[model samples]
Target: MVPTYLERFGDSVKFELKVSLPQNTLPKNTVYELIPSFRYGSQVYAFDKKLGFSSDSIGPYVSPQTKASFSMPYRDGMEKGRLMAYGQLTHQKTGKSLKTGEEVLAEGIITTSELSQIGQYYIDESIPVMGLSVKYGDQDAYGMYKDGWTELQRLFMAYSNLGFAEKSEYMKVIEGRGDFSHKNLLFMELKDYDKVRKDVLPRFDRLAAVSMATTEKSEMEIALLSRQIRKGEISAALLNEAELAAAVDLEPGLGEKEVLLKRMCEVHPSAFSFNNLGVVYLNLANRSLDRTEKNRLLASASEAFDQSNGFFENPYAAYNIGLVYWMMGDKASAYNAFYRAMAITRLDELRKVHEAALGAVSIYNGDYRLAVIHLNKAEKNEINLFNQGLANLLAEDYYNALIQFEESAILDISNGYPFYGMALIAARNGEEIILYENLSKAVSRSAYLRKRAPLDMEFIRYHDKVGFKDAIR
Candidate 1:
């Protein structure tokens, strides 16, 4: 009879060998010899000790019970190989040996190569594998050989057997000759076009036919692909493709300023975007160099600001509109915008606007004392120090402006504007030693300030002084 063998536990195997004796035969000292062997790949091993049995029974009685066990050593790269056990039983009494059918117990095949590749891939992607079983199958076979084989098969199916499902998912995000419009819409919303195009799209294209034929598609796989795409580390072509899938709707003959503002409002309706749209319009108006374009851009800017106010209560929006009105020489509207901004948020920034407004009103109404009072109050706020100094200079309060500029420079030494203002004050006061020091510092801080000094109101008088231009140069 053949040996009945079974794997009893992890790293150990159990087998029960049964041998038959001749009928009506008996020996005073009947001895049975048993040898066990196992083969794996090109390597084979025999148990070091021979299994021995002796019995006095006759007439087909079972021989003395004997059990044998052999340990299987852990081997790398042996997962794909098969293990077999073979043995023979011999009777010592008559020197007869019977080759009990070579019991060949086949072990499950292990895909070590595939498992190593997957492990390396996970490492490259910075994924942690702690606590998770490395082998295939459930927790019951966590460290068992069968579990490892099972895991290998599962991974193989994902990469090969279900290739078609993966390909369809990839094409859905890349807009490549497929109905990927809805996927593209989702991609655009998630800002994940680039990743889908670079990684998923290309990988699928390479294995397109295989993926299309796959039958084991899974929602988890699709979700994982989407997450990887949104990480934004992928290519820009993917983003462009997604954008193409979700094409923008545009109207004919729309002004550039109008179009930009409308798109900003529709695509990004945040307070920051609205305020930025207003600034864009204001910039275009300033650079138009044509009265018609300037009026058009300013009108567009005003409309954007109005739209911004509806979405967000921001002081900067009102303040920016006021600046546009002031540029258009509309004093009443400019003042109204400025006052509205100031009321919305009592930001010290509005004090500078109020100072400028009061200075203009005082000069027009011939109320210098009121203008000085407003400017003095504005000068007290750290936010308005720069503008306050400039206002004092305009009011011909040169000494006071110098003091204010000096204080402002001390507060923010990196501000080249204040440094240049200090240089101007020093030169105007004929403090040549201080002038040289301040100008040198200003030039060191900013090359632009040094180059523009010659064209400045305060520095123009001393532009030709010896070594002054050379120092700036």
Candidate 2:
């Protein structure tokens, strides 16, 4: 027997068995039957029988050795088992059979193939936004209120993987970047706010009332809370108490924005107004703690997006609907919405949205080839590159997946997902030290991944190893 141990690849465990039969070891009139099996505890799994050479059968034998190979589907509890072979010799003339003792062949198995990750389609939540022309640092060009602009900026920066402290620190950096001075002059260009104040506001007193109702936040508390909500560290309902009350004190004006947008929709249900309203509900859902409340908000947002789409073929509205569906775990509906967005526009800037959704959805569907094709078409980024690596991993292309993960790590060192992907590759290759190194680095960077490592089956073989436990801790 070669290797003395078996290795598992994907769902199967395979090994080679070489048997040597010395010349004249068996009588010419005798025949041999060999049975290969795996034994664990009291259970035995047997393979198909193979017949050995017999001179009486008129078979020409050049060599006195028999080389055979076996592959069987892997099962649980087989990891701690041993391989065994049994033989029987039958006399041709006398019709007598002699049973041979069980022979231990090799010990198995190394189950490192369980580390491959299942890929999923995700709506690129970062790209979709409310309002028309609400580009970063250029919210004024779209006639959005300053409070709404601030909320939108925070919404874009929110990351579920980040902790509250990290999120708050990033928010400070954003506020310090520039004092929104350049955007102010651009804001004045919005149909000449001077004209809106003297002509429109005076004509419609209700518009003045709505403008007064717009809430302002001196601090970006909702940004921190949004990160917590996304992380599941805290829920929107819990923030109502005094201890964390400051976080949702003003509700980040999401409520106010909803009220104002609803009033605006009653008077003028334009595509832009309805789309912005949908955006408001989406944010509200992000902050919601209760599953039912979140689902309701997502449904409301989807309906608003549908209304926006009916008024005009708005790509943003389509993309937003896709995001809502994704959050709601409706993969089929999300794919359709994302596909619709791509159909509405082929602009290179929006390629990320289309490629990511389509590729990830393909992965979720177990179509690795299609997922790779879509991912390959997308521009490189931490998110898409990581998904590309995941797609390749699922396709059993470890080499390409490792390359993609390495590239993704280079793009964003702080991102734990790329490191986690590399750790999975290391585990699959049975590189224990490398696995521990990468796993340690990964879990150290993201609290989310730290919690996932112990439960992940990829490292099941090393669960008892000290290095594995320490790395996850």
Model 1 scores a C-alpha lDDT of: 0.46
CA RMSD (A), model 1: 39.5
Report every candidate's CA lDDT.
0.46, 0.63
Candidate 2 runs further than 4 Å off = 1-253
Q: On residues 157-245, what C-alpha lDDT tens digit does candidate 1 reach at each position? A: 44432355554454343322111222334444543446545544445434422321121324454333333333434432322211211
Lowest summed-lDDT stretch of 10 residues in model 2? 133-142
Best by lDDT: 2
- Show how many residue pairs clash in every candidate, following the order shown: 5, 2
lDDT for position 221 in model 2: 61
Clashing pairs in 2: 121-360, 121-361
TM-score of each: 0.36, 0.51
Q: Tens-digit lDDT track for model 2 on 106-132?
A: 765754323222222212223233322
Q: Pick by TM-score: which candidate is best?
A: 2
